[model samples]
Target: MWTYLIHGEPTPGVARLLEGVGRALEARGFRYSPEAEAPNLVLNAITEENPKPYRRRAQATFVASVLELPRFPEEPIKELYPYLVRALSNVLLAYVPGEGAAFLTLELGHYREKEGEGFYERVAERLMPIACSRLVIDNIFVPDLEPELWEGDELTESMYRAGRKLKEWDLLPAPFPIEEILPPEDLRHVKRLYGIGGLSYGNLSVRKDERRFWMSASGVDKANLKVIGRDILMVKDYDPEKNAILLSVPPHVEPRRVSVDAIEHWMIYREHPGVGAILHVHAWMEGVPATPFNYPCGTYELAQAVAEKVREAPDPTRAVVGLKNHGLTITGRSLDEILERIEGKLVRTVPMS
Candidate 1:
């Protein structure tokens, strides 16, 4: 069942906005659920007076902060980033009574919902995917990584060199500067809640065999990938029961989690064995068929969507597909080949919707 809840006491303006939103959602089969029921989506209504997270019991529960702002700033990304990060919401809905609506995603995707035909319906359509999507970031660490597999292998070296190449091309942008952005108390809360120092970007992976692959570590400097089971980890498979990616790492080493897009790469690699390498960047190119929506990373919906697009491409092994409001995911026969083909073609700035 589709369940949603509007958290907290809504002010006059917020109540008015949510009334329409609730009706639209009910038309689409979503019922108003109480927090005790663990609703699929929670619209945390925050005003200039009070702004805080609802701190729901389930981390998997998607939270979209409905902020009733007096007026939006000229530069929303700069202004909204802090709110979204501090509140730990997946998306931020900035609303003005009769003005308009704008939102920013965890990926820093900022979009505005223009008032027009099906305006409320349009907002519902965009929020539904996010509400339905569940993050697949749980990792079950195994202490049986073979010493021979840690580093010094040909595939591992290739990954390191490729990571450095990405840095040369200025693709591996730094992780969100959470340390510099948030204050101590709020920072501690966010850190404790999400277990994330900062949001990382861009990942590279190479097929190891029919079943396994090696991928970049999350939240690390891509150019300086040195340690195995730390910088680069082997993705053995996905554990459906655990709802986590299975990683094999050295018993003595503390391993960092694999990139959140591990499942997306895993799906593509499993579907098309010919795809020897995969690269995802916060950059874009011309004429690539893109996914209709930007499903958050680490979700099965995103993996399925990207896989379907890759299957439809002329050549699944060497296809370039765009992730709407995000970036590009390119498949190639090798990392070198992908880098070569994308040379002089990638637009440094990813155009947001």
Candidate 2:
């Protein structure tokens, strides 16, 4: 059983919202307590007018508000809030104050009865799992690579053939039920990788051994990368002298080329055995360290420059290097470590000048 305390002043609408939220929780076997119970969660809801005019691109005029969890005296509640927000679809902001409390803001429009039920259902689905498990959710956001402006006929044919081969091997899974795991807002990242709506630009790699690593294939939709052999390529036989990076395609499987960033990943892994994973994303991060030179993408010079920067970095295990005018290359000791480092930094596109 779990206990909760509802915080914030109650307006008529807010009161009704709380009741709806309570019913949703009760349906899931969670109980509410008026007394301050140890290990209890708080639901802070607020209703306020939009202080500034909505942006020209904004879809709605009104905004709903959910406050962040206060700094609980216990460490578990304090640590649990961050993971909770990751699964909430309506979360607007999850901010942590340096000296005080951490809070989450959920934006809602003017609340009607139907809307209230939907909102409570969303909140219950996202929060109950964490509340029960008492574990932090480990969902990582890997940004998608932008669509390549040009595609050769041969390349398209090759991808089609590979897709068929994947089907024959029974490697592709059904469309991901992200709603079961994450909130709707978080689904955008998954959709991008699945190629549902837009082209995603990025490559993810995991080191298999000293000789090889597994990486996303060039032109493959990342969102569909739910299964291996169909969505990923095994990169092997790295020969720096010849700049040859080979894929471990099966005996009957048609060969697929590794990501363009393979060489850069190879150079880093070859130099740093402790590095276990690498992620390359196309976006501009405000404060990550940048490479001194801007080399063209998919070139030997670019790979060499990136490797050199990684060697120079104080903490290569968690270092994120900016590829001037291109994107970012991040390395970590393991995949989880890599995800933890790039968690909030993944973005869809670079701003235009």
Candidate 3:
């Protein structure tokens, strides 16, 4: 997970793309400024045309900016926040542990043309739902020196209560069946699941049977030397209707309502089209620098940033980095492939200060 800013010259194609964009700008009775800050408008113009090459160039330019630019000034973390925020969402999705599933959904309207709507309101509308959905109960008042009730055991219970209430209201996402399957006795695959230590629990995804996929059950730690079938949990006939609703599981024990983040995962499948499996794990140490700053991970901006990255990446398989404090999401054509990416990222990632 490298982070920085990009600047200087961009791909020659980008310059050509910008030239075309500049023409479109003139057509719209707008003009580019001679100032250096004009690149932002030029880039926006390129997006308007929506050409493949131009978009590719834009992505390359963005990556280059990220790879090359200096650190963001402290005052503007809110303004110049990088796609890193969404990357954190991706990470947290991966490591969201438990028996249920988690996902993410982008507010398609976020990218829609809003004419003359206020930017702040548009941003709020697009991002706030994704953020607030996780809050469970709302509108409660809090006293100074006292935290909101959403803390610890009380908070956990409240979350469950909220989940139960959401389920009653039919507000939760449509669930995909989470079935527990006995994986074939392939020691290699077993080793892959338990590669980081603990037990040998493997994942296998089935797309031909879109209604169902297999997962190792809760309580069956992948590090255990032997994992039995009884330990596996099955979520059957999930998303049978293929609706937009997403499902999630809490991080605690037993069967609970699926996670609100499940919509994000559902969106991944929708956006990527062929993505079949995902592996998530909460990896520590990725947030060494922010630890001192007390900067939290997994916020709305992070989710949006990562969702855009996932949508833009040539292959979701390559989008491994998530929020620093959260975890990882690895998607691929099969469970084995997804798991490999998850393990590889964890094994190779060296923390930054």
Measured against the true structure, the TM-scores of the candidates, in listed sequence, are 0.93, 0.42, 0.31
Highest-lDDT candidate:
1
Model 3 ranges with Cα > 4 A deviation? 1-261, 284-305, 341-353
Number of backbone-clashing residue pairs for each candidate, in the order shown: 0, 13, 52
lDDT of 3 by residue, 1-353 (tens): 11112133434433432344345444444444444321222232111112111111111111111111222233332222222222212101110111111112211000121213342233223222232222110111112111331122322332234334333433332322111221233323322422211122122222323342323332233232122122222223224243222222222323322222333444455566577655444342242222111111223234344456566566774455453323444467755454444442343232322
Q: Over the stretch 1-353, how does candidate 1's per-residue lDDT look in tens digits?
A: 78998887777887877888888988988998774557888888886556676776675678888888888779987888777776668888888777768988887678888766676787787888898888788777898778887664787788788888888988887788877766787677765655556677899998888998889888888887778888898899998888889988988789888998999998998889899999999899988899988788878999889999999999999999999888999999988899999999999777776
Off by over 4 Å in 1: 48-50, 179-195
Greater lDDT among 1 and 3 belongs to 1
Q: CA lDDT of each candidate?
A: 0.84, 0.49, 0.29
RMSD of 3: 21.3
Ranking by lDDT: 1, 2, 3
Give the runs in model 2 whose Cα sits over 4 Å from its true position: 1-200, 226-230, 240-242, 346-353
Model 2 TM-score relative to the real fold: 0.42
Cα RMSD for candidates in order: 2.0, 19.1, 21.3
- For candidate 3, which ten residues in a row score worst on lDDT? 88-97
- Tens digits of per-residue lDDT, candidate 2, 1-353, equal 67665655655544665676678888888787756434334554542221111111111111123433333324432343234333322222222222222222221111111233266665555444334422111112222222231121232333344334334433332332335545554556534422222122466777777876767665566434432343566666555554456655444334345666677887898889898878676555677667654343445666777888898899877778877545678888765566556556555343321
- Arranged by TM-score with the best first, the candidates are 1, 2, 3
Error of 2 at 142 (Å): 29
